[model samples]
Target chain A: MELFTPELGLVFWMFVTFALLFLILAKFAWPVIIKMLEERADMIDKGVVYAQNAKEQLDNAKSEAASYIAEARKQQAEILREADKMKTQIIEEAKAAATVEAKKVMDAANLAIEQARKASEKQLRQEVSAFALGIAEKVVRENLASESAQTKLVDKLLNEVENKN
Target chain B: MALAALLLAMPAQAAVTEGEGEDFNPKEIIFHHLGDAYGWEVPFSHSQRIPLPVIVRDCQGSWHIFSSNRLNDGASYDGFYIAHGGEYSGKVVGEQDGVQYRPLDLSITKDVAALWIAALVVLLIGFSVTRWYKKHNMKAPRRWTASFEFLVEFMYMSVIRPTLGSKAKTYAPYLLTAFFFIFVMNLLGLVVIFPGGANLTGNVAVTLVLALCTFFITNLRGNKHYWKEIFWPDVPVWLKCPLPIMQAIEVFGVFTKPAALCVRLFANMMGGHMIVIVLTLLIFIFAKFGPAVTGGITVFSVLFSLFMLLLDTLVSFIQAFVFTMLSTLFISMAVCDPHEGHDEAEA
Candidate 1:
């Protein structure tokens, strides 16, 4: 019972002692300790914020890089397609040129063949006429055994030709 | 001759039971340990003790300062003595002509001596930490200073900053000091050895002073808006009209908050010490049965007391934290912007 009761002396001593303690510690101890602590806490907070910002920036860069890669791949495929189309067009143009050249060469060769046939035909006719004349003259010379018989034949052919005229 | 004199003195100073209690009163044992005394009896020894100084201003208006050993067993030294386990168990009273008046006993009793030791230790720690900061400026602390920094930082971040908000930076030093002081005292109380077992925090007067400090700071720094919120709260108009009951409760809360802080710390610490003493005393209480019974009881007593002491160790930290945390909370509430709470509620 007495233990629970508050005594004046103890209370006074406690008040004086605690008041002095609080003041001493607050003055001497706390300033340095608390300042250091606050500085450290602020540093930690700044560190976390910086880390988060860096992470976000990295993520953004990675996404942007992915999009860039995709765009480059698309452009590469388009260029390859254009080159393929141009290659096929060049092949078609070469084929058309080769056909026109072949046609001109065939026509020139046909004209040359026709002129040679005509010349041959003229020479054949003249040769045939000359042969006929030579044969007839021999025949006249031999059969008539005289010029009169050949002349009679010639005169008869000339009279017939003059009546027809 | 000295040796013979010491041997004689040893027998004379052997453990003397102060109270007239039969059957090994465990209650008396607890009271004896928990109460402030003029002497500190060394545990586990019979004849060794330290006699504290006794300072008393008696009815004669003159001061008598002497060794408290003169008042052994309620014996008077210059008409002053300490009564043990009575209506006036923990006081110094003077009897002159059958008139008893309480003396102003501002003496270095057991608890006072312990308080000085605790104060010295706190000062030493404070000085060393200050020196560390001085020696190593802007660099990270090392070793024990690092641990101390961690503790202070924890209090700053967890308790002070969150509660006090902007004012936290200003009040952090005082709050940290209060926290460390209580923490050291509680831990010191847990040590049962000669040098460390001083129940400084368990004393009501010490807790009261700490609470008083908090109370004063909170009330003194409180703004008009705080008082307005307490007196005329942002409640329904009818609520205010009803006998101002809400307002009265707020006023009561102001005082009770600090009172609760003091009582809570004192009771918890005192209770822990009592439980430890009582548990150990149970063995002696059962000793008359038989040697075998006494041996069994002693074993259980020692084990249970050990467990209690461990629990007390944990309680010491928890109570200290609780006390400091509550103090921080109360002060922050008093000083924080009242509109912030209202806005939060509205949102």
Candidate 2:
């Protein structure tokens, strides 16, 4: 019977003690602890989101850099090919100009040589005609010294002229 | 050492029985240990008790305060005495009109002192955890604070949060306090020394107050749908119209929930303490058969007591958890949305 009994003093003290504990805890302790826990959870969640965003941005930057490098390489190859083509065309043009200049110089030399040969041939003909005339005159003079020879020569000339007519 | 101890205890038992010419009575011995007293008893000595304050009111409504030792050995002080065997046995009684009557005993008994100690322990834990959170500002806890935080978080997240959902925060303070309060008392009751041996949770008055708190919180917070389900449940019209059977059962169930909560905790803790005391008493009961019987039974009794104490330690934790979990469920039942229940019922 005593075991089952609920004494008045015990009940009063229990209520007083338990109520005091509850009021103090609820007002001060629980709020702070639970708030800090929530704040920490929120902070961790934000940190994870921020990390994911940073990773995505890094990936984007990496791909963009790779594309830029590829574009620059392509441009470099195009420039190199254009320069090679220009070098070959310039060489061919220079060779053609050199050949034309050499041909022009050879033509001028041939014309000059022909003119020089013609002039020399004309001078030699003139000298040969003059010499032959002078030799004939000397022979005529020597033959006239002998009177009889002169007369005979004149008659032979006249006879030849008549025969010709 | 145990045989020597038992042999030494034989003289004390002989001395007690010699005065009364009676054999050892285990019932009175167990009850004395299990029940509350105005003074704390020293181990191995019944006469030497640590005096505590005794505040009592006479039948004429006059309050008096004095040390409990003044009333030792059937002594009386200022018309007040501790009744030996009567309707008010073990209580401060006063004579009125040739009739025995109990006073308004607001004295701090052994159990009340232990209750205050348990409350102080809970407050210490609460403040320590609070201090850590305040200083660190969301940083992790360590050592005792860490273990305490783990218990709180586990209870909140697993039991309270799941059942109460959004309303968990509203009721968390009371629920968490109850959990720690009961758990601390249960653990304190397991110790056999100063500030530990009082059976606070096993006391019916203490459990009644705790259960009443749960009962009031549940019923006070009950939604409109809850009352409707209780009074006019979605049952056959015949049950409500003719018999009112379901309504009666629902109303009965509302009171039974808290009642069961009170009795369950009280009975478990009380039974555990009783069993330990009973086992220890076995040694004295077997002492008459000779030294061999007494020594053998002492070993058996001591071993069994140790085992039971270990078992009670686990039961302390489990009972606290069970009480808290059941309270959370009951509160959730009252506060939950009607639609969720309707869906479940249909499924």
Candidate 3:
């Protein structure tokens, strides 16, 4: 028999089989395929959403961490600066106290030395005056014991008193 | 045999003699059997040939547009002639002709008519089940609906969705059309017996057109990334140097990819058809030799053809899937951003 000849017999039989098979497949097979497709689409969509959400959360976390680190560094710097200032102030106060204490010790030493020198000078002067008085009394007693020497002395003294008057 | 007798009776003088039963050559038999004295005819002259969508023919000196399988019964077969080139001298069919020549017509061709019927049946069943669900006012899907729903979900998750992503919904119609079209064509090949046994999927022209559609869509929707890859690919200096040569080669590669898509599908489908037909022909050849040979060859041919038909049916679905997947891959490449990674790094 020639192939591809258009015979109603072949055509009719083929049509019937085609219809039967198609109906069976549509009823039994196609739905299953379509349902599977829809489910797969949903799963993919969910995955995409999950990924996006994860990415956003990650970004937020990173920024938050960066900001927190910056703030901590700033606080650390401030603390260091305050500590430096306090150290300098303590050193300056210590130096000033040392200077004031040294000044007071020097003033006390000068006062004690001046008082000792003045007392010593006063003693020396008194001793010198006593000695001068003793010498003068001794001289006067020797002259008065000799009568001639006493008269000459009284005349000279009279003449000197008259001339002086 | 009846049909052969009818054809032989048509015109005795022009009739090509059939070889003697035992001496019959299979190739000669097939050639003579299918050969027409008048080759395909078109009405337009050489000057009038313009590449467009019309097939005009001049048959027996009558000028007419060669339309195949028109809706009208007798008029459907009247327009065109299919014959060997030496037997008849008419006009050669080409794209240059103002008319588009479709080699196969679904409405008129016997096997395609069967396929059309099958498609209708599939559509009807789907509608009926959906209607039943609506009538019941069920919140959940009924048995038939549920089965279909599950299949769709499975395909979406495993196949379509993964390849195309969330935007796959936008392409669902085309994907569905491709799947059903391939499935129906495969099924028809199994069931129908008519001219050339109607291997619709086997037709290279059909596959070429389908591949072309994918190619166009991929290119049309291309983003910066796709073009960048084509025009200025990020390759090593050794590969990228000699700008003109690499650029030319890369551009050619883009076109070749789609061409491969067309050729692969066409070759696979046509190869399967040819194998099945050749095997089936063995039965006739054996019958011509002797009855003893007939029985053995017939059994083998039938079994082998059946096995191949089942395989072909599966292959049809797989081919459609591969085609769609490649299409999605190409389009995704086109639409993806070139600088996305860099932007992410900066962020």
Listed in order, each prediction's TM-score against the native is: 0.73, 0.81, 0.50
**What is candidate 1's lDDT per residue for B139-231, written digit by digit as tens?**
777887777777777777777777777777677766777777788888777766555566778888788888998999999998887788789
Clashing pairs in 1: none
Best by DockQ: 2
| Candidate 3, B1-347: lDDT as tens digits | 33223222321112122233345455643333222211111122111211212233342344344434231222234434332233222112222245424233222333334345546645654555456545654344557666645434545555555656545655544455455555556555444233223554555444555566667767887777778777778877667676556678878977987888877776677667656656666766565578878889877877776677668767876776677667666655666453542343244
Give the DockQ of candidate 2: 0.53
Runs in model 2 with CA error above 4 Å?
A70-165, B1-22, B43-45, B287-304, B340-347
- Name the best candidate (by lDDT): 2
TM-score of chain A of each: 0.63, 0.67, 0.61
**Candidate 2 residue lDDT tens string, B1-347:** 44324423533453355335565677876677678999986556657778988998887778999999998988999888999987888988888888888889998889989999998999899889889876886788999999998888888777877777777798889999999999999999877666777888899999999999999998999998889989999998999988899999999999999999999999999999888777777777776789999889878977887778778989998999999999988888898786664453344
Tens-place lDDT per residue, model 2, A71-145, is 999999999999999999999999999999988998888888888888877887788778877887888878789
lDDT order of candidates, top first: 2, 1, 3
Computed on alpha carbons, the lDDT of every model, listed in order, comes to: 0.76, 0.85, 0.54
